[model samples]
Target chain A: MKNNILIAALLFAAFPLLSNTLVVCPDCPVNTIAKGIALANPCDTVLVQSGTYYENNIEINKDLTLIGEGMPVVDGKEQGEIFTVENKYFYIEGFRIQNVGRSYVEDRAGIRIRKSTQFTIRNNEFDEAFFAIYLQNSSKGLIEGNHISAHSLEEANSGNAIHAWYCSYLEIANNVVKGNRDGIYLEFVDNSLIHNNLSQDNIRYGLHFMFSDDDSYYDNEFVDNGAGVAVMYSKNIVMQRNVFRDNWGAASYGLLLKDIFDSEIFHNRFNQNTVGIFMETSNRLKIQQNEFSENGWAVKMSGGNQTNILSKNNFLHNTFNLSVHSAGTDNVFSSNYWSDYAGYDLDKDGVGDVPHRPMKLFSYVVSSTPEAMVLLRSLFIDLLNFSEKVSPIFTPENVIDETPLMTPLPVFGKV
Target chain B: MFKIFKYSFFDLIRSRWTYIYAGFYFLFTLGMLMLSSDLSKVVISSMNVVLILCPLIATMFGVMYYYNSREFTELLLSQPIKRTSIFTGQFLGLATSLSVSLLVGAGIPFLMFGVFGSDQAGNFLVLLFNGVVLSFIFAAISFFIALKNEDKIKGFGLAILVWLLLAVVYDGLLLLGLSWFRDYPLEKASLIASVLNPIDLSRVMLLLKLDISALMSLTGAVYRKFLGSGVGMAISVAVLLIWTIIPTLGIRRVCLRRDF
Candidate 1:
């Protein structure tokens, strides 16, 4: 690590003195970006001026900076991969890259970083690209302020907007991504920070991570995707202050956690989703101070979830507060404010005197007989739920908030 | 017809049952509101009560009023008033008085609970509107049944039976059919079946607003399009209007044909 830092420091110091500038335009001596790269030496800066460059399969093997002035357009013309960076210490900024060709055999992208470190891809707009920005085994990269979109209607035919695989220490922020298979997907990626991004209208999950650990994502907005976000088989993930909204479908949810461990999800807002938070086999999760409103089901817990603490959240006007498929969960739910709580505070405390149970018998019935959902809000169903509430039957007995707040907890932003 | 309608309306409005029915609803709604702080939930609970109790009460009240007012009807029949006029006036009077009791009973508690200041006001209004419509529909049907049967016991039994069929049995059969045909696309069939039963139709109308997530889970394109659009709401309302008109027209026709 010390040697790597020393080398980076030396290279950083030597870059300004040794680097030369090469201008590329339609009428310039080096007309194309590929030609400019070919003519320039290592550590040089290629300034591509405003022009439509119809090129593809551009490969950079050395450390270089490709800066586009006036937002030059690089139309791949449905050919292939646009920029393939294989060496360390490169920067790509201020370009509009579009129309990377779709391929069934190869995973193509507009900007691909392969085994490269200390790169910055920022201020670029990608339109109709199969994969807007893809990082493979690349570390210490910064992808910021890019607008990425595609017109993909199916998951099989599309790629993610930003896909990181086997990467670490990446900072991805201030990006807007939409209408791809997934807005951002990470696999085997660790120790990354993703914040201040807006991801919406994707064919699949807005932000999806699988087998990725030690990642933190905060202040991001995910809306109207097939499923808002999914964190699967991951550990030690910190999710804070994000907004998940309008993700409505039978199988969709605001956030899905499967096999996740030791994660912290706090201060998020889940609004109008079919299911707000779905957990399966997730353990030791701390979920606090979130606001869930107008969802079909606020929180659904399946089997194998243990030691999860749900604290101080406000659940407002959801159809079913909690639906648990498991017989019991070793989870602690305390101090949450439930709008459906009917208990009184006789002692004049702010909290209710009686413990409030969020799980309902009708939710368990719906879990087993999904078609019975049509009978929701019916008199018979109401009677069933009332009887079940009067007597502890059908629903799990342990899933109760001991200290239910009488009033809704103040949300993050308003406070 | 107008003068007779006014007299009958005032006569029933002063009756003991009207105050009792209205008072029952007022007290129930007030208790529900006081017990539960969630106004939306109270609205839902009231909806169920309105959906079930409204029809049952309307049926019993319709039969009782028609039977008890037989002397008044015979006295009116001896006058120069038309047969259709007398029956239609009494039917309208009974329907309007029951509806007024329902509206005032439910509305006063909701208003007292500050429901008008909340977003749930719309849902509450729909619930009351549905209650009024159900009252009219069940009363008209019971009036027609009483007109057909001279025996008071038979007419009352048949009226209650009709209520039972629509309120509970129809939904049971609908659910059975849906499950039996679970493999097939049952969206259009389910919607049509619901439209056939006035009770189911009203329940679905409420469900469209209250539990849309659960409704949308049934993967039927036509069902989604119909319920998700304004056109579907218009169609459901039209169907309900047609339901009320048909039973009322039947009452008129039976009254004109029957011999006292």
Candidate 2:
């Protein structure tokens, strides 16, 4: 036992010799981040101190830990990509990077990880980077607590904040992203988790998903984005405890689902958006325990969505509760609390006696002739809506909440 | 000028039409609020009414007041008051009373609904501001028309015609122009046309503030940049101010030269 202990102690003491801590400073022999990485061995840590390093096209080819002390400024000088990692077990934290050149030919980024596994990127700030953190074929990664911002005046020249392609088993949490083309974009990124993030004021959708499957996002706040969040051509996704607010634009929505299949969206708040949730050609979705308030149109389902269940949700003070373009939609809406429902609960149950019809005739008219929307609040339109409620004609008859709650359901998620 | 303004304001306030107008607004706003049970919807409904009715009422009232008070003004001209002061005083008095009626009438219901404690207070304030500006602009234009035309029938007819041209015809012409120039970049042209008409300008301003979701859907970077930033708001407000000032100055100019 003593011999074994001595051997273990020797191995533990010798491990430090194998992995070195290389310091990079202006006055030191290793001044630049690239130089430090070039001299570093596998399992070595490269420490970068506080200074402005005007360099780009840095390549990290080994499994190394890069820690920045005092928040070093890595100015790409509008040159190119700052960091390109190709090896596994890479960890980077605490750096301020800026000014990566905009290129239409190449997808330049502040940090790009290629086919790397077991990587972590945290506590970094990126400004003016075309693509802040670009992950391609990366698995088992954690991208946490990063702040990315860009002033993208046009979409053709700008890139996304966090662009993930063909990535799996990734966790992106507690990051703030603003003013990019898309805040966080995922393409074919499956089995990932995104949570606790604030994405706002982007030039395009705050969070965009395309052909990504089995992903879950929770506790994320998206506000004032150009087109809000979009989930497209995906399946088996979960969205919960998120806040979509103030995404007010002519073609904007709090959440847009296109060609999506078999998703669950619950406990989300949609507030003051142009359209809270817009679904087109989506199927088999479950939407429950959500709060929709003060939006222009709460949910606009078109393109013949099928088999979606909407229940236990609160529709509070929305201009139009539901706008279903197609007359033969097979979606189910029951046990939901609609603030505009005028039916009474004479039986003393919590449900209204008469089933509440949410789709209005005027909304249908507005869909057909958009210019008629200017007469939205006019007495003529109000009279028309009232008469339609008395006898349904234009609005779809199937889109009714049979078990409508008399009072608003308790709001889901955090206020 | 102050004494003239004070008496004219008091005299108009005591008139039956002011109370009737205020009562109409009061009952309508309160009834809408009670029926809709939503502050924002009520505001929107009231905005539609204000946009169409304020200009019509202002035009008719301005013509009628100027014609009815012609003998009074002649008597005042014989008094020691300056001609400009007398005319300016009456204009200010008419505009101020109309604005007050609008404010008190709409303000009572909005405040009763606890709007001050709500998030839509800013939108409500903008609505009221648009109403006041519309009243001032249309009233000034009508006063100018009345000042230039000595015949009462001609003055009244021309005033209503001006209102019709602005409130309805201008939009029709604008839509026609937009469709005609559909192949060109007509965003700037449409925006300029809206700005030239005070009624359309105020409508767009209030719509931009209240119903932005609908407007933001418009296709064009210029519209987005203008409406999404404070620059658009400033420009709209500035143009509305110019609209108000220029017409009032026109009234002053004609009164100075006219032998009435």
Candidate 3:
């Protein structure tokens, strides 16, 4: 009788020490997710079963693990933000959140993380979210394997997917963001790694950066967006092994770098964009080993870009290879392969004997007067380009590839 | 008219120059098909060649056939056929023969490469249609020029000069005009200017069908709004028809009033 009483006392003492899992279902006592989270302890797990829960403003304010079983639908019913996480050490996985309402005043998101750190938002599906996976002043977050999509009509009325502001050390990988205003927007963010994300068909830029520095994005694809990727007012950016394709429009480009300094863009494939890479006031960029094919303009540099090196790149079949409006000094174009290079190498070297001038007279004229594009493929323009190419007259004389490769470089193997 | 058309068509088809033109196209198209694996790329490359070569060859053939067959044409003029019918039949014969040579020559290689089974079938059809229409338009214009001038050197010179004006000088002047009116909206003006010339018209039409229209739309929203709609296509087709009709009417008017 004494031993039995002591065992009961021990069992009673160990009960609160163990972490409890509260299951939330339609027929359960704890029906709603909010109730389950409310009744759980700080480190407890809230397991939500498969059902459509029409709820909004599900606030999470403690260290908790929210796991959805069989991918439960958390429908916001177009009300407002769905999951507002404001605490640290939180984890959410495998929930289908949808229909956070559009508001002109507030940026409604499916999952809004405010002042949170060390959070993992993984494998969630979001549909019609105004701004999906919004993180403000958050750090050390892992946002992986999320499918965020929205049917954004215009830039004014829509918001971005995976918007991170004032965040650092973010690992945003394996996310498919489509049809949003801007997929993967980062403003005032630093030291983040974004990889293997397919951001396409967004109304605005696929991946956008403003005042973000020391970010490296690789193996990401930006396809058919409004303008592909735009990195503006940033420094020390490393972009490698990304693809920018089919982002075609009046003011579209594969990559737009404005006021960006000390960036490296290498091993990227830019195909079928209006302008492959448009640099404005960007300096000290090392662009190398890229394959630019079938773009309208491969690289269009304008406005005081200095000390940029474009070497060992392959430019094939673009309408206009390079168009430099005001040519910057020390902008080197060396050892690149140009498909339009007609110079031969009599000495049996791989490099051509004559230097190649990629800027055409017609492109120069069209730059000054865009209306002249109506005569794009005219014989007169071809004659003028040929005449100008034979002798450097209108184009900047400093912009020339001295050692153009005779054959195209093998850029596909690295990718 | 049918007899005259048959006679002229058979006579031209029997000539060595017709065979040579057809053979040239066949060899060139086959070479392009063999060289490039991409159908759309081949279509674009062939568009460049067709845009330049179709009008030039049609113009040359029209003037050369008129000059070479002067004796036979004079013999036919003595017959009891209506003047409009004779000239119209001759014009149709020349245009049809040229189109046939283009069709059989370029079409054979495209068919061999399975263009009909490819996604570029629509673009290929547009290309051939542009080629045929260009042949008819240029042939009618050159025939009109040839009939107006009795001097062989003057007629050939005038025909060649007309080709140069439409093919080269018109674009230069258009460029100059566009640059001069840089601050103003020139999309409509440029569209009108291009439609005025059949070569530029055909080139624009083919460009719209190709992927390069993306680049062209960068000029202005007016270009995008106009060329991105069915109304633009209808207007282009109507203008092409007008281009074909007005010159053929000129040919008929000159044939009737002139003293053969």
DockQ of each: 0.26, 0.18, 0.64
Give the TM-score (0 to 1) of chain B in model 3: 0.96
Candidate 3: lDDT of B94? Answer: 96
Stretches of candidate 3 exceeding 4 Å from the true structure: A1-16, A413-415, B218-220, B227-231
Give the clashing pairs for model 2.
Answer: A250-B216, A250-B217
Best by lDDT: 3
lDDT of 2 by residue, A1-415 (tens): 9999999999999999999999999889999889999999899999999988999999998999999999999999998999999987899999999999899999999999999989999999999999999999999999999999999988999999999999999999999999999999999999999999999999899999999999999999999998679999999999999999999877789999999999999999999999999999999999999999989899989776999999999999888999888877789999999998999999988999999999888788666545444434544456678999999988988989999999887767553
After TM-score superposition, the amount by which residue A56's alpha carbon in candidate 2 deviates from its true location, in angstroms, is: 1.8
Query: Which candidate order results from sorting by lDDT in descending order?
Result: 3, 1, 2
Worst 10 contiguous positions by lDDT, candidate 1 chain A = A368-377
Candidate 1 wrong stretches, greater than 4 Å: A1-17, A411-415, B1-71, B80-85, B88-135, B145-196, B209-216, B219-222, B225-259
Ranking by DockQ: 3, 1, 2
> What's the TM-score of every candidate structure?
0.82, 0.76, 0.96
Predicted candidate 3 versus true structure: per-residue lDDT over B154-208, tens digit per residue: 9999999989999999999999899898899777898888877888888887777
Candidate 3 lDDT, tens digit per residue, A252-279?
Answer: 8999999999999989999999999999
For B1-260, candidate 1 gives per-residue lDDT tens digits of 88888988999999999999999999999999999898877887788889998999999999999999999899999999898889889999999999999999989999988998998888888898899999999999998898899999999999999998888676666666766777676667777887677787777777666647443476333555686688987888888899889988998888888888
